[model samples]
Target: MPSSSASPPPPPWLQPPFLLPGFKPELEPKIEPMNCPSGQLEPFVTRDTLLFTPPNPNTVPDEVENAFPEHLRLAHHLGASSNDHRSVISAPVVEVPAGPSDIVGSRKRKARSAEMVRASIVDTPDRLYFRGLVRRTRMTYDSLRYLLLTDDHGRGEAGLSDEITRRRKARSDLTAGALMGNRDLWLNRDSRIIGCIPGIRVGDVFFYRMELVVIGLHGLIQAGIDFVTAGRSTSGEPIATSIVVSGGYEDDDDKGAVLIYTGQGGRERNVAQQRSDQKLHGGNLALERSMNYGIEIRVIRGIKCNKSPSGMVYFYDGLYKITDCWMDLGKSGFKVYKYKLLRIKDQDEMGSEMFKLANELKQNPSGGRSVGHICLDISTGKENVPVSLFNDVDNDKDPLCFEYIAHSIFPQQTSQGAGSMGNGCDCTMNCSMGCYCALKNGGCFPYDENGTLLRGKPLIYECGTGCKCPLTCPNRVSQKGISYELEVFRSIETGWGVRSFDVIRAGTFVCEFSGITVTKQEAEQLSDDGCLVYPGKFPARWIEWGDISDASPDYVPAGFPSTPDLSFSIDVSRARNVGCYLSHCRSPNVFAQFVLFDHMPYPRVMIFAMENIPPLRELSIDYGVGDGYA
Candidate 1:
């Protein structure tokens, strides 16, 4: 806590958040602060005036204050000052409160009722073992959904009239989610509890509603609430398990740690205007009972994300106790029930809160990130999005002077002229499976309508310069250059690493791994130098990420594309882009994809996000864990 020096308060965004006693600051992510040219960091300070700080209640909307009033004000006053930012090590799984009660003087409590042990599932070995499986399942469903949307996006385009539309009326999200659910590919269906789901993290993100169903986060596909019926609850009363605050029913409030959630029904979504009085029969009653019982409920907030292929990102923001619930008159003449849910203490930072800050930074990098910006665009206008260079750790002005190159420089012999290409896709809009390039690439277009790579293959064929398809075609994602903002910052453990100013969604194309291409023999000789990137050594994480064959024994799935043999490696020792600076991790948030367009026979390594990545988290790839930095 800062000394009361009677100094003025910082701006709303810079206000410090209240720190829970045992939060263990060491759990925050370690970001190497760029030395402020003065050769040192701003001396730990009042915790309020840092460059990119944590969430401030003062910065949130009016609804949060209106709903959670007194407590929110207390949270703002208790705003914690931060020191270390260590995100690698997560704190313990949040502990749910002991026996809450639908009836305060129930005989069950007098007779010694059992404490909530179902949440202990989060700490069990079974949960640990299935954690990786859960991740794989979620990503697989998303990738399949994206692939389906590719075929379904162009409904009335010119081409074969006989071409069959796969999912015209039904959305791709529903189809992909349904396929995964029917196969029993998901876990935890037999039992649903009042606390955390096994293997799901607080900040983990989902792109589709069906994804929520498959992963057992939220059971219902469309309804806002997922709860246990009257007979199932310990008290013979319905109990709420989870609720999604989707800004649906404009009455709900989402201010990160504190949420003012609206009960389901009786209103126009987004408009907040009520159609009829909301009833307390099903989910609404469950929520009220849960509040009286003191049970914690999972809160997944859905925010619109332009970076997401599905145009929405569902963020799991830990558990929240329904502290209060009551009926209130809505803006429309009808009555509505609103629940006041407070986020449990000591969990991870809400990804949605961080997302808003990241968006602000992207909109005005100069204004939001007002300090420690070493070089604005390290690429010097070479790429579409600017790559920022920063070093706030020490006076060390590093990443030792290397020439910034946008595209890989291959030997003249490997290059092929555009007119020399043997083929290209002719379809103008969304390239159908019947297109020439689609067929040449084995069958389907490898990307979704939003330009997210559906799956990585031995070789992903894109419309080359000779192709009749426009540059904005869905298949032409990699060639667009870096779509989002990246920063080269110095870290304590890993000297120099790359991160993003934007919250990168899973499967979005990041950048191409570019450098001077070298022959196999040359790569072997320079390998000892410890800078050569052997594409052959890259793992099949992409294939594994898209693997859903284990959904059932009877589900004979289409085979994953084989890993292509590579005779060359990229020499990124000198000239490189943001991709070269990506650190190595066994479990990385990004993966390498093999793509060939202008380079036809030869493929360029394209980097893509593996999951919903929050801003300022160091970007990593599944390559050799060497020298810490890439």
Candidate 2:
């Protein structure tokens, strides 16, 4: 999946060390300089190879933002503001939409880019479309800054231009705003729209405001308001199209159904630092016109969400007609314009409100979401957050008796055994690709700050307790206990299954398969009786996520395995956690991954959300061949 050619023969779980002729197991071909990023082609790993790659070690964290500049505006997943900017040999297909008009790119490229952008927002299913959009946006942005801080190379800060360093000089909401703006990926840009966007549903959450920009939702990245000038409006008056209510203006009030929204402008960008009289211009004027014309403007509300990489999330709360508008004196003593936006009835429940309800459910366990909840916290005090046991289907008091444990229990013979593998990093805070730990993961960190797996790998090496990096380090994702609100609930079909009240974003860490580690022989004996969890049997979707072969055809896609090399399996019958209750399906939304923090011969079984999952949906995983109960 990584640039395996430049590196040593990757661990067995990865692609074959030698090139394949027609991907044959035999008949190794001679070397050739191909157009691949790795200078060799790649193919998906064979499913069986999962059984051979022992102690897979690519779970390291990405860029160390704590040790570098804080203002990286692009996607912040793997290395939030990744410095590992190794340039791709082939230039990225440059079909950005808002580049200099004077330089018209190829028409074919433009058409392809526009079509993909439109399809991403208007045609496909919400889960698939958003996942591809968000993933591609991050990958594109990461590539743009290629040749920045490399994994094995020296820090390349001195090589970056001022514009790249300053991150386009905007607020945090505008992460990757420039590329999406200048790139030719957008369509519906004529403005003057007054209704809901195609494909976008009410309560849909976005991690960045720039995502709102790319999908033709709200165009203004930094500005709170988006409007059509008087010349463009049908009524010959400035009119508003959409507005993002993110508490930029203190006068704004978000009441779920009724929003007492504040009109942008009047004060300096600095918080309460300067004051100015409101003007009847730009978005301010547009809001007034929209209110008078009874125009329903799209409203996306954003709030600080630590679960997101950008530390924020924007929820599309559907359309709201501007019912009232007026000039009002502001808290800073300057006259400001305000508008009352009334949510149109019969739309989906507001996403922000749902988020609020989910938070409440987490805090109100004893009494709620507690009516069916059997145990407020089945984990007792083991997990960082409690895992509730709820059974409304049948009167099951709790899951089969088992001791609650956080970390997987490894056999004495299988443990890394004492001396460190030197798998940790020296980073004081955020672990970067340059850290020794990252090198173990094929010269790249495996995750972003939010603990989202940037790319699926055979193994992910996290910053363990041996590392100087603090516990807050992003690399220590799997080590951290479950962070979401989960419940082990009984179902009519699946019996005991797991679900989440929180909207789990794609690639976010879910939980680990905590159990007593057993040898292969012991696992075989328990397989027929159930409760034997085999890490190698889970689907290896790394190729779908993005392998080096996607960039060029030089390398072959070999070793795309459904299984990974392993010496042990988990015996979850007598002792297990939430992961044991998860079900298996053909269209599963979750996947199992191999992770290690101590650089041991064995990796932990960490579960990650493979797609964006809405609240209360039963979580499922693919059992290699087809759908089956876990």
Candidate 3:
């Protein structure tokens, strides 16, 4: 039997094709830092002409006073010397109890705080492992070894050849052990040898590096150090040997470090021998350390690997320790090797906090309506219900309608809701780019032409003053009552447009669904498969609508008295459609949102409206639809 690794190339279904386009030029925004406010005053000391001299204890007060001029003489009996004779005196202090040695104690407290801060900022072993891995992969092997041995970044020629030779010998020994058994007689003398190596101790650290060579999809060659240990002979002669062949190695310089003993013992004999054995173990006594260790590999540069087709080789350089090895004889022509190591802490945990924060933000709604709550829909008076009529009656009892409304009204409340909602008007006749008004009172009426209304016209529209209305308003009261308008002349070029309105305010609605007539059985069937039935004939419609024929045998229409088995019929004029005939631009305005009437079990897709809808701009949903990221 052939090895599983020797199986034929993976099917196309297992691999996706690459569709490459030209790269988009980056748009850099210029940002300048604001300067500080002006007119800030500088700190300085005031200049004055005041000097005081303490009187000598032996001298008389009158003689001391006569030493100065009359203007500076002290005022006595008559107090007629001069107005400047008064001296400005400093305040005298009264003794108070010292409060708990504040000065020295505070200094000590600050010192302790600084020490604690330093300890908190110290790097963990895991962090060191990850940083070492990154450095090894980004630098050459010689450079890495130099950094490790000499604590420097540059490579040195000293001991380079010897190190490389030792590595080669170790590799050969490991490969030979893997292929056959250990040749050392001292270790292989017993029947329980099982291809064991002798002379290596149980606790030594060694570096191992090897290239994996895969041959004919089955054979593999691995060369690396094995185990490093401290062992002793029956005569109590201490020995420190590295099992360089298997997957470990011992450093000669690491002798007599520290030994962590865990085995049981009662009788004591040779203290000197025991001390020698302890010296052989090395390293600060870390008893029962985890079996896993660290590994680092030099980055293999200038190698290009293709992800498509067969006979491809992918190469990546990194560090990991080999935890297990197996050679299954049952699986002919194949060998399996398993390696495990501690995950690089820095790289793995970089974005974890951000992801957690985002999740929390999503769960807790902050301000107004969440973007997910809004829903927009277009309707006609015939098969489709008018917007006013749709809003007048609450379809809260219908689970589908209820969820839709909830999403439209409080989009953030539910995890699933359309991000944007608005009205669309069909305005291809009046404006080539598209008009924002709807037909009212037999005429079209226009308002501010800022294009905000025109941009959202694909969603909803209202007639402006310039509409082609046949009847004129009789009075202000009559005009107020006739606020609703009819949409006409939707353009394929303009795509699906939306009208900007301040109806419920942004983020107000959380849920909304386009309500269409469907049989109960049909809805149930759709529910089972997790699909939506949308009305309309356009191939690019967001949802597919089903007629009575698509309904099940037990189908029943909503609000109908009799159960009639009628043929399936779809309303062409009443269905709301998103026009996709226009060419797509990098930036587009109109978007779409869809509700699955049937499938509640699967993920749903939602759409949003762009800020501007260019002429012939293609409408699209960004949820893994069409060419992703294209």
Per-model TM-score, in order, reads: 0.70, 0.62, 0.15
Which runs of model 1 end up more than 4 angstroms from their true locations? Answer: 1-129, 152-169, 264-271, 275-281, 305-311, 326-336, 418-436, 448-450, 465-470, 491-495, 503-505, 545-564, 599-602, 612-617, 624-630
Model 2 C-alpha lDDT per residue in residues 1-630, reported as the tens digit of each score: 112123234222223233211111111111111111223232111222121122213210011100111222232222112111221111233222222232233221211111111122443365444444444544333322232212323222222333334443333223333333333433244322357655456776676545665556775444566664433332334456777777656677777898997665555423542267766555666676567556678888777776655566778888888888788887777787778889999998888887777777777855445356578788897888888888777777657478877788987764462244564566886776578876666655666545556556676667776788788887788888888889888899888889887888777789988888887877766644776767777777544442322222232332322233576788877788988888877546788888776635677888887655656668987767654642
Count of residue pairs whose backbone atoms collide, per candidate: 20, 45, 72
RMSD per candidate (Å) reads 16.7, 18.6, 35.2
Tell me the RMSD of model 3 versus the true structure.
35.2
lDDT of 3 by residue, 539-628 (tens): 221211111111112222222111122222111222322221122332222233222211221212223232211111223322222432
User: Best-fitting candidate, measured by TM-score?
Assistant: 1
1-630, model 1: which lDDT tens digit per residue?
A: 112233234223222232111111111110111111133221222233221233442222111111111111111111111221111112222111222222122111011011123545534455544555566776767655554455443312222112113332335565555444333344455455458766677877676666777677776555567665543333334556788777756576777788887776664423346688877655777787667666788988888766554567788888899888888887676887888999999998886876777677677666565566688788999999888888777776655488899889887776575654566667777576678776655566667677776655666767788788788887788888987789888888877889897777788888988888888877666745766878888876766644444432332233433445577888888898889988887557899888777763457899988876777678888785453231
**Descending-lDDT candidate ranking:** 1, 2, 3
In angstroms, the error of model 1 at 361 is: 0.5
Model 1, residue 318: distance off in Å is: 1.9
lDDT score, candidate 1, position 73: 16
Error of 3 at 36 (Å): 16
lDDT of each: 0.61, 0.56, 0.19
